[model samples]
Target: MRVGIADTTFSRVNMGAIAVDELRKHASVAIERVTVPGIKDLPVACKKLIEERRCDIVMALGMPGGKDKDKICAHEASTGLIQCQLMTNTHIIEVFVHEDEAKDDRELAWLMEQRTREHAVNAVKLVLHPKDLERQAGTGQRQGFEDAGPARR
Candidate 1:
């Protein structure tokens, strides 16, 4: 199966590289990469991969700036990704990291790698083994950080 990886040039770390690395661990899965200038462009890139390249699923990766306007754009981009998924009838795992998510560059890099890898796994399962994810439903699983779990009763 073909899995598309759509990342942005605005990212500080090479999230696409990490995702490709993690995805290569699995067998019989092909990866297609499309790098855009910013987050807002991801939806179209992902759609292209889905419709043109015939990807079974896609991972839309982006690093939005911490500014208010950037956050708004990220939300809009996320909505576009959702719409793209519905239109293509395929899964597009949206992996977005805000620039201010961590305190330092080192931590931020780690978070980006962690998040990308986690979502990479999700993308694989989404097509190859969706039942795997279904088994973990409602578990509060998180990417790039510790799992929150369900709020304590």
Candidate 2:
């Protein structure tokens, strides 16, 4: 399998680099950096990677500042809802769960709210409880069964 890694900003290059490195251990991987200018670039790069490079899976990486260093997402937020308005070709896999609030289940609601502001459109808002999101949404499309699980716990 060929996996493509994308991170828009240099601030989180370490996180994306670690992910890309780990992915390369198991399959062919291509690492690309997209600019944060707009959502258009993400999908375009994703499409090119998939169609041109034949990347089987595209992993969009971002640093939402809540989770640990290396976590990535299928969606911009933790609710597992993909922000397609930004890019059609990209798939966001994992969101950062804030370390301080992750221990409290009640905070999931707030997390969802926070996620809304992180993206530009802020249109695709979803609940952030890991259990509910997983049970209800089925762990976001494109994730391996083992890879799809609770965000923090």
| Maximum-TM-score candidate | 1
lDDT tens readout by residue for model 1, 43-147: 999999999999999999999999999999999999999999999999999999999899999999999999999999888887788899999898899998999
- Tens digit of per-residue lDDT, candidate 2, span 1-153: 455544455232333455554554443434443334222245555556556666545554444444444234323333332443234443444333333444454454344334322321111222122353445464433221124443554
- The segments of candidate 2 whose C-alpha lies over 4 angstroms from its true place after superposition are 28-41, 65-153
The residue pairs in collision within model 2 are: 66-98, 72-94, 73-92, 73-93, 73-94, 74-92, 74-93, 74-94, 75-92
What TM-score does prediction 2 earn? 0.40
Q: What is the number of residue pairs that collide in model 2?
A: 9
How many pairs collide in each candidate, listed in order?
A: 0, 9
* Candidate 1 off by > 4 Å: none
Cα shift from native, residue 94, model 2 (Å): 4.4
Could you tell me which 10 consecutive residues in candidate 2 have the lowest summed lDDT? 119-128
